[model samples]
Target: MKKIVILFILFYSAVFAQSKFPVDSSYTVKSVYDKVKKAHPYISYVPARNYKTVKEEKEIVYKKIKDRELHLDAYFNQTKKRNPAIVIVHGGGWRSGNKSQMETFAIEMASKEYSCFNIEFRLSLEAPYPAGIFDVKNAIQYIKKNARKFNVDTTKIAVLGCSSGAQMASLIGTTNGKIAFEEPNSDKKFSSKVNAIVNIDGTLAFKHPESIEGTVAGLWLGGSYAEVPQIWEQAAPLNQTDKNTPPILFINSSVPRFHAGRDDMIAILNKYGIYNEVHTIENSPHSFWFLNPWFDETIVYTTQFLDKIFK
Candidate 1:
């Protein structure tokens, strides 16, 4: 009876979320516009600044299914030295947010001679938890296979994500050798291993005892912990951490609740002698990466971390 109840709840949630997050331009699921609207008085836009962008290639399809396609935008600098790369994921509670949310990061990083790809995956309203996870992992695999074309140094690839996207980044970095999270593609020999992770305000664990993920998370995660225990456990980076997990850099907002399981994961990383850094942007609101001043600080921390690990 309990198993039957769980399946019913999961099925119903998936059906309902699809309706709520229907694919439309107005839904802004794939737009650069901020969705965390007016949650704070300071939650306003800052102009995106970048260096002399000699080249930017947009709408490059990484994954496709019939008419539906997942695209990534790549930013590049003029350099013969195979550039270090980043696969960026944006966050909007896993139900909203588009790839373009991270365009500023890509443009800025590219100017610094790093190749960055901004990606959009299936949101909870479109699919569910692991779907988004596999999309990112597969995107990494795609990047590795197409390294030469993108002028990327596959050995120095990193996954950078913001908000819930950060949670997904942590999970992807930890589960490097695992096949369960893979979404198989034409590149059978390609590996999705990332050398480092840049997690911006994404919690390490969703099934933590104190987790208050709420409905937005549930919409992406499929069901509550009671309904889908395994999915919740599998999605948490803290649970998947092993010696193979890459070094991680966490940039968090001032919110305490968002730092769920961070210290515990750091302990695990330390035990394995895996390098990690934590930078809390003091007095900053959540989604500060999309804002100014704090966003610049984040870049400094991220570049230093990535340089330490990859350079």
Candidate 2:
């Protein structure tokens, strides 16, 4: 009778575990960290600055999809002279995140004489892969088209993003003039090419054999590397490096997962004679951009990079 009771208990436990997070689902289950984050979303981390001269224009519509209106927030000092611009893309593993998450960074950049556009894009939940690429490209084109209105120097623009956003920014910087990635109704007259790229610990390549099967990359790309090899290659910035690729700055954590393919990417860029630099923050978490001290250091590295590239 005890053996039969034990068997019944084991069966019930198995069923409960399967129901909690199904093993055969197309999407991977969210990590414990992701779950905790969803319950308590992170707040913005803006440092104390003496400069209070920044101005902002919030929720400027950039694209319309059916009834959905995508928008960007612009920040700049009200200067007569046009300033160089940076477009900030927030990261949430391609499934979550919004433009406002990067507002503090934008405000800081604005105070430093750089026009900043913090943009919103489709996540993997709404659409996957090329959808994000197209949205970011469209945002850049929009900014370029309306540069005069924003008092931006159209020629001096950079792309900066964290995590998945960083990956997308890298793609924009490397794949300029790649017609296949351009959106259908985008402003073709103005180019989406950026002068520099700042990658904040995003993945650079996705073709390795030991790559995980159902994490954020798998879900965002819509399949495992084995199932969608071409898409994986197409989405990787490492595979898209070329001569025309602009200078890149990498602000990264010491985590191996976040810095995957960093060496390979640098090697490819070096081979093509492209300028790039990597700054790894020791003893910091992957999401250090959202935390203190690290946040300040991030901005310092970022501004230095922009100053050099814009010069």
Candidate 3:
């Protein structure tokens, strides 16, 4: 009888421990995270959306290029009713990476009562810079065109991205009202303006002609700094800063060389008294926050920021 009681107590303790996070485990992509399943519940919690319709579908929004597949995942819950929407962009230096990295994030947002779209754009090597940005613009128009089907509020659309994805997100968010990014063939005139933006370790200085040299900027932009200085200069988000720009949340590591111009972007944002927050991980490695303790921290801070802005 004593042995049975002892085993019961042990089982309960193990179950409780699993509910909490494992700070000791190193961060890994979602696929490898299954190994530490016993110690982490956050992993399972992210991809379970409460929406009525949750599925994957592919569409061809751009026609200039063939074989370009635009993959999207969506979630919506009727009980929750109409909610804000957020489009997510994953980072792989513009050359690689896919929409799956944000599957858990999309689910989490849906659980929070926001319809979410995890989208994929063209890669630099495949089509290049303006191409990806153009892809984003088309995706927004497509969403707004099908807003009724997705149950999105349309007016409360927001965007979030990390690393290279951050750069693309910033560009789309900042250039919302601009005419230069408009798709010539599409009749969908819904404003591209995003209500809020969350950029993690993204560059804001793509507009600087001199800075465009010798980086992925060249490949994505389809030319080196020398070849198309003007395109690089105007393509960056810093050039589009203004008072009406949406609220922004910036999260980054404390690395100096990589994040050199983020402070200036923050300063520009302050001029408008528009809400902005920067959370820097002291001495943390670049993209370090994407792992464990920091990963959870990112979600908490990001969700809090979203709550404040969206509410």
Candidate with maximal TM-score:
1
For model 3 the local lDDT of residue 289 reads: 39
**Better candidate by TM-score, 1 or 3:** 1
lDDT of 1 by residue, 100-173 (tens): 76787788888877889998799877798788888888788888888887789999999999888899988999
- Per-residue lDDT tens digits for candidate 3, residues 146-217, read 888777888888888887788788888888777787666655566667889988877787643223325666
Alpha-carbon local distance difference test for all models: 0.82, 0.81, 0.70
Candidate 2 whole-model C-alpha lDDT, 0 to 1? 0.81
- lDDT value, residue 56 of candidate 3: 41
lDDT for model 3, on a 0 to 1 scale?
0.70
- Residue lDDT tens for model 2, 201-291: 8877776442342577888898987789899999888888888889999999877767667788888889888889899988776777775
TM-scores of all candidate predictions against the true structure = 0.86, 0.83, 0.77
After superposing all C-alphas onto the true structure, candidate 3 shows an RMSD in angstroms of 12.4
- The lowest-lDDT stretch of 10 consecutive residues in candidate 3 is 19-28
The candidates, ranked best first by TM-score, are: 1, 2, 3
